[model samples]
Target: MSRTLIITNDFPPRSGGIESFVHELARRRPEGSVVVYCSSPAGSDDAADPHFDLRQPFPVVRDAARVLLPSPRVAARARSIAALEDCDSVLYGAAAPLGLLAGGLRGRVRRQVALTHGHETGWSALPGASTALRRIGDTTDTVTYLGRYTRRLLSRALSPAAAVRMRRLAPGVDVERFRPGAGGGEIRARHGLGGRPVVVCVSRLVPRKGQDTLIRAWPRVLADVPDAALLVVGDGPYGPRLRSAAAGMESVVFTGPVPRAELPAHHDAGDVFAMPCRTRRGGLDVEGLGMVYLEASATGLPVVAGDSGGAPDAVLEGETGRVVDGSRPGPVARALIGLLRDPDRAAQMGARGREWVARTWSWEHTAERLDGLLGAPGRADA
Candidate 1:
């Protein structure tokens, strides 16, 4: 059996796109040879969840401290786990501080691979620190990007050999759990949204998520479709700001921090999914692939998202969903309005989207591809 260790900064109990990807990948991994090393949130237990073969937690530091001291106790923790499991390869989920540790442990292991969910190459860090880590990542044996945009960015930032080794591997959705006919009516009824056209947005309430832009566009959406309601799922530091901005909109419902188990219900209850993601001020944040767009598509819901990052890749223009420019609210508002007005067209798009997801982006397919990579000679640590 070939043992693999996944090192990530984000994991369960601290929900985000990367966290979900890591957990799901571990869950669906082949029988008997996988472990995870994650940076735990302060005050959280370091115990391993029984579901995973091994879970090692390391102390996490703030961004400033993380950049200042890139090599933390986490490096030792990762090494210890790799040693214990007799791991064949080390896979990194992102190029954060945790990735630095994994890259540092290269000589101690047989093979090393880094996975880029989004913005790894383009993202800016403290000058000296960013350059140092980029050098390390560029020299790693293999690198994986979740989208073409990310792959391009890494190609520019890394060496020719490292960039060539970088492959585009999109994240997968659990089709069975996030299906079209799963929990539509039940979720709507439970949320007291009976018979109302719902527009759902699932993402962290951060500036890049463009919750404010969505809220601004809500008034226009309501002008056309009075009974339409907006449901905002997930929460972050911007919760209060989003709530305050959304004040006086009776149709707007902020369902703060819904657990993953209950997310399918939220997706099913929606008539359309809206994610007006934008580049945050200073160009610091961006969407990698916007995995929720695929999840929304899996539930047979047409999406209306900003034309940024990998959104265009998943949302087919005038087909499965509409991709509009992020700078303007008119385009986004029109897309949502069009879908709301034509339920038949929306349903058709949704049906096509479900088919596309089933054939291409299911988690099972992702696992099979990863299995091939992991099993290949000289591809892993062993």
Candidate 2:
């Protein structure tokens, strides 16, 4: 078994899609075969969570900085960790900035793989960042992209050699954890939503995520289906504004940051899942394949995704769900109304989504592709 060094700024105790993605992949590697080098979360010290590292199956070395840059100091530390662990491969959790360490660690590791998410697409269009991306491409063995939309943007910033080496490594959902009948009954009853039509939006309460659009469109949804309810999940800086927008509307309920274990049940409580996310800041901020859409689909719920970046990639338009212009509340309302009005059609779409997730979005398939990228041997139980 070969050892691997996982160099990343994203990791557990810090919350976000990338953080979860990196942590899941690292934990799945063979026990004791990986060593993680990550930075501490912002506003926290080494004592943030003393037992966090000990609970991990592999060693986790934390840097004092809140964010790790690809400076000489970080490079030297990464090289030291790689050499000390005798790691044969280096996997960068995110390509930009940190991927620049590839050049410094070339001789220390046999293979290097950097993963690119939605933000990298924006970085590819910047001046200095674009040049850094090109250098990262020139040095790393492989750079993984989440979907075609992101790949198209990043390809223009990478060298010809690296462009050809780009691969897809999308996030996968745990089917067993997020499935139909996963405690949804209790959730609905507890919330006094007994058998009422519910549409759920699970994501940070940010403007780009279109929770505000959903709130703006709620009146139309109520006009069409007066008994319909909108369930907004998760928390963020935009919560106050969203609450204000949804005020005086009892149909709109905000569940303010549910625990991770309760997420599947929340999904199950809804007839449809929606997050009309839109690209903002002239494409600088965008969705990176929308893992929440896949998780909702895995839970036997049809999705309504915004056509931003790779968000649509997670939905099989017309088959499993519908994609709409997240900025327009009219279309979003219509989509939700259509699904809510026709129970049979919604159920059929949900069934197709569940099947799609089982066949294409399983963690097994993602783990297999990851193994191939890292040249890792197959685990009988994986």
Candidate 3:
């Protein structure tokens, strides 16, 4: 069987939406058919988790650098790996600077595919970065986008042919792992949230993710539903700011980055899931699809999504949940309050959301799509 070189900066034991997406897709590929070439996880030098690579089914080659760029040395190493492994294709985990390596790997690799997430949307707007993005689109056989919002912006930066070739490859949820009754009781009991109407937001505590907005809106939600508790999960640079935003609120709890295995239970603990994400830096910083919304939906929780970029794409409006203006505390508060106040309505929406996720956002479906894409012939074959 022909093999593929998975070239990426994003991979586990670093955690994020893009990292998870890439790792999931690569792991799902046929055994021995994939070989990963990724940079070392963010800190701790080359000595970082020695068993991370050993645990993988396929070979995982780690670069010494903490972050891999398309610099001459990095590109040279990628090309050498592709050649050494006899890889028929090259898969770039995040398109942008790393995808720039596609130009160097062209004739050597039969197929080259680059996956883009939220950050690429920012790159599409800048002058120099936009040109580089166009080049990446030009060199790679395909450039996959997360949603319509990203596609629309990226299309402007890509050549007509590249734009025409752009395909939707959004993240997917694991139905079995994230389904209803996935152990929310323990999470609630641990957090001292006994019988309270809980609203959970699972994401990196960040400015754009609107955790601050949710914090600001918590007071209004409490005013309407006094028993309601706000659960903020995950940690980031914005944690301090978010904590400050929630000061003096006893009902507000921060889990501060739980293990990945515990995330599903965190979602399960919430009666309603909300992330009032807003686009910042003009349109540059935005949500690509808000996979957490889909994950929340899969866990049978009614979502309150922000109307930023492609985040609205994850919701079915009245059928699943409300899409609120993430910037303002009033609309976000009202939305959360409305959902918290009505148990029957929220349950109905949650049920509908789970159904929608099972039908449209399963990891099986995404893996199949990626399998077909990888199997498709490229320019070299043509």
TM-score of each: 0.87, 0.96, 0.96
Candidate 2 accuracy as lDDT = 0.90
RMSD values for the candidates in order, in angstroms, are: 4.4, 3.0, 2.6
| Model 3, span 1-382: residue lDDT tens | 8899999888988878888999999898988899999998866423456578789899999999988999999989998998888899998999988999998998998888899998898999999999999999999988988877888899999999998888778888998999899999999999999999999999998899999999888888888899899999999999998888788999999999798999999999999999999999998888998999999999999999999999999999998999999999999999998888889999999999999999999888889878766877433110
Against the true structure, candidate 3 has what lDDT? 0.90
Predictions in order: lDDT = 0.74, 0.90, 0.90
Model 3 weakest 10-residue run by lDDT: 373-382
Total clashing residue pairs per candidate?
5, 0, 0
TM-score for candidate 2: 0.96
Model 3 regions more than 4 Å off: 44-49, 377-382
TM value for model 1: 0.87
Question: How would you encode candidate 1's per-residue C-alpha lDDT over 1-382 as one tens digit per residue?
Answer: 7878877666665557777777677777766666766554434323424323234232222221212234656577667777887887877776654556655687777767667766664453346545644675665666677766666665665666665666556689888988877777887877788999999998888877777788888899999999999999888899999999989988998988776788888899899999988765444466777888888999999998886676677777788998887767788889899999999999999988888888989888877766765655334211
lDDT of 1: 0.74
Question: After TM-score superposition, what is the CA distance of residue 125 in candidate 3 from its true location, in Å?
Answer: 0.6
Clashing pairs in 1: 88-381, 88-382, 89-381, 110-381, 111-381
